[model samples]
Target: MPDPGSPLARLGVSIQHLLPQRALTALAHRISTARAGWIRRPLIAGFRRLYEVDLDEAVVPASGFDSFDSFFTRALKPDARPPASVGTGLLCPCDGTLSQAGPIFEEPSGGRIVQAKGRDYSLAELLADEKAAEAFTGGRFATVYLAPYDYHRVHVPCDATLRTEIRVPGRLFSVSDATSRHIDRLFARNERMVALFDTAHGPMAVVMVAAMLVAGIETVWDAGLRLRPGRDVARIDFDPTVRLSAGAELGRFHWGSTVIVVTGRDAPDWVDGLVPGRRMRLGEALTGPRAPGRAEN
Candidate 1:
């Protein structure tokens, strides 16, 4: 017979996990395509106020937005951030609440991600690549969650050349703390766009995770890919020759979601202080060894 403690805990987690995904998905679709000027205006107003969105920074202020999708994925002023120097160790790629940021650690391969206090999920599932997973073994990781009021575009952390891109499609679940703590393998299960960029810091990967109502995630290189909420996984690869500058706009989320940066074991040791729940911004240095040979600058 199953242990009583195990069943009870699993039940709580399961129910807690499923509720947010359903409610948020419904909410996402309704708001994203909402056409009623009156209804949509109030909804957008509420989210803007709730998330404390900075209208001054938006390229198209909230009043100019036509739909919730536009409002959610609003662009920022070109001068909002200064250009990043390639010599700096690394720069943050987005403006969001640092939901969780730290090193990826587990005793064995295919180990779990530290979702919260007692939770962990698989590396293989997160990257959706067995060989690619090994590159990040013992490396660092940072997960940033974008709220409705945040800047939606993502930038490059360092000077890197595109190697490949894999679109691992899956369910679009809400990625709130309530969901993160309860959902098993939440990141892996969610539809995500993975871009593999090879850099001097080592092979770095930026995973643009999709959440409920986040209509889709598009990159500057491949702007045509569109995704609808569903259980599916797709993979796309690119030639290894395409290189981009540090802090270059790499991708954008149709609506708010999460962005994760994964670095391999070879990354600099100075990246020791980044922890979960910390805040970050684009073009700010994160970490890199000072040595010229090991540096990407």
Candidate 2:
């Protein structure tokens, strides 16, 4: 467990608990969307230097972006992150630290992924849809945390057809590692976009969780999320024609945050050596061979 007494951890908790979350997030959104070169350029440069972002892989040159959001969610060179072999089962959806990865238990409703060493959040609250949560009741979940320097775009972990999309609005809490260790129901309490897909492995859900300072979450299909701070869950049914192959771009965070992937009980087992704090790139293998009796959808 992380030490809550540490200065950094203590400061994180203060920000999460004491700060005006929505106002701060709105300010961040304004700064991120600002087209003024004076504001965006230095902000981009400072962030790149601070986080050591690799501008070489970015599709647009650093000097080419008109807004911080453009550079923050920059596209990578096509070959930057390639897909794994077809039969490898599941692939990681983004570049980030694998904060938590394991089974989803049923008793409490949220599957068994840990938010921190000792803290856990329910999937039902995360998804805000009991029926959607049920599909992953006895399944698996992986939470990947993206830092400011990481690629903000997310991808499909497997070939799948979009089934449902849910926008669950909530408070925007800072999702830093320290906050995860100290804040209870951190992920569930934060605003998130849950997209359910019907894949060969079964029903898989890619949850885009918003963190403090994050402007918004956008998907390829819907550029405007229109997430209100206190609205009830907004559900969207997708046509079967909406499909994406493994490694295809799914969505992106305006600023870095976290993504949670949940799969049904029949999904493939995670590969050995995959553990908490492991840094993974997009398209890396996440699962091993399929378990007996588990059939592809």
Candidate 3:
């Protein structure tokens, strides 16, 4: 658990509540989308420097990205990552720090999810749909925190068909560790996009949650998704045709955000050694290979 009385933690939470979050996000959106080299180049360079971004892993444009968004969401080299073989159950969807990972408790009201060591929140509240929340009772979940320097794109962890898309609008508080500890139901209260899918293991949810300065969220299906703030929950059902293979791109966040993956009962065990604070890479096997001796014996 984070230090409850940490002065630094309280400062961040206090600032978020006082700031004009929407207006600031709007301003950030303008700067991120600016195509002019004069506007984008300096921002990209400073960000890369500040984040110690490993440009060697990213495919930089010969000249430069027309906008910081392009650079932030730049594609990797074709051979950047190896394909995720079927043997390794689920693949990680993005590159970031593993904030939390484990089983979802079958609580009386929908279910319960862990936010921190001494913190847990309602699964139903996070999903914004009680029915949808029921499907994940007694399940597995992993929350990845994408840093500003990490790759912005998200990917499928397993073969699955999109079933529904939920747009939930709420506060834009920082998804940082400090805020996650201080903000009550941090995720359940954030503006987010919940993508439900029917995977081989069972029902799955990939929640793309927004945070401070996060301009927009985009899925491969809706590349032009212009996410807007709203009061009501909006859900859209998809046809059966929206299927994607393991490791396929799902979507991306404009700057950076968090992704919470949840699976129904009987979800495969995540690869061992996955503890909070560990850095996870996209396409890495979330499920580990069995021991050769055990398999043979």
Candidate 4:
């Protein structure tokens, strides 16, 4: 595990978060504008070099990209990653480096879940809904961090029909590992979009966490998201009739950020040896099969 309190950790935290709050917010506003494409090119090139991104599998060749965010969230070839076989296990919903995975340690008061080493954020704060928080008490969670070069589009972890989608507005903090380690309540503090699904494994929450420099969060189901901006908390409730299958495109992060997937307590454990800092592709079985006769919720 990364020592979030070590001197090195402290240095990283400082470096990742050197920007002023207002400056970062201005950067986000700029990135969201059409004029930002000028800087996006060189920025994309620099990031590709810095991260040593593999372009071979990208859907649109990297050469085809006109901006950094465009390249960052580039699509993958259809066959580059195949979804896990049906009934296998939880799938990876996006292409990013695995940051951490484990059970959410519930707090004694307020039903908060510790997001990082020293930060405790409530499920209600994370989801912005009392009933939504009720669905995943003591459940499993996986945090995936998208570096500047990872694929930005998000897919489904399992065959889930979307039950409801909520947009919980909050401060936009940097979600990089450095920021996660330094900023208290990083994930919970960020502007986030939560998609709740009813899967075989019970209720699943796919949270697209926004960070500093993130232009916005967009969904395959809605285009109106592009028009909203500001710090107020927002929520969108859907009728029960909407459904989304696993491996389906849930949405895309305008720029890279962290994705947190939470499952009910009955959800099975992760496949052996899948740990932090690992690379995972979509459609791969993340967890092992359930014990016999335990059905997916």
TM-score, prediction 3: 0.92
Q: Report the number of the highest-TM-score candidate.
A: 3
Model 3, span 1-297: residue lDDT tens: 446459967976888899999899999999999988898889888987898877776787535678988889898886787766747379899999999988887766658888986788898999888898988877889999998989999999998999998889998998988888888889999999999999888899999999879998888887666565467888889864599988899998988989999988867777666789999989887876545454310
Candidate 3 segments exceeding 4 Å error: 1-5, 84-88, 289-297
Clashes of 4: 12
lDDT of each: 0.75, 0.85, 0.85, 0.74
For candidate 1, lDDT tens digit of each residue in 1-297? Answer: 233236555565466445666467667667677878987798788887787777887788678888877777677788887755547477889987777766678665554467666777777788788788877877877788887667889999888998877788777767776667667788888888888889997989899998877767878887645544335555656644678988888989888889888888776653444666667677666674445454331
Query: Higher lDDT: candidate 1 or 4?
Result: 1
TM-scores for all predictions? 0.82, 0.91, 0.92, 0.83
- Candidate 3 has which clashing residue pairs, if any? 271-286
> lDDT tens string, model 2, 36-148?
98999899989988889898888899889989999999999999997878583989999999988888866743455578777887787888887778877678888999998
Give the residue spans of candidate 2 off by over 4 A. Answer: 1-8, 86-88, 108-110, 225-230, 289-297
Clash pairs detected, candidate 2? 104-112, 105-112, 110-122, 110-123, 200-297
Which candidate, 2 or 4, would have the higher lDDT against the true structure?
Answer: 2
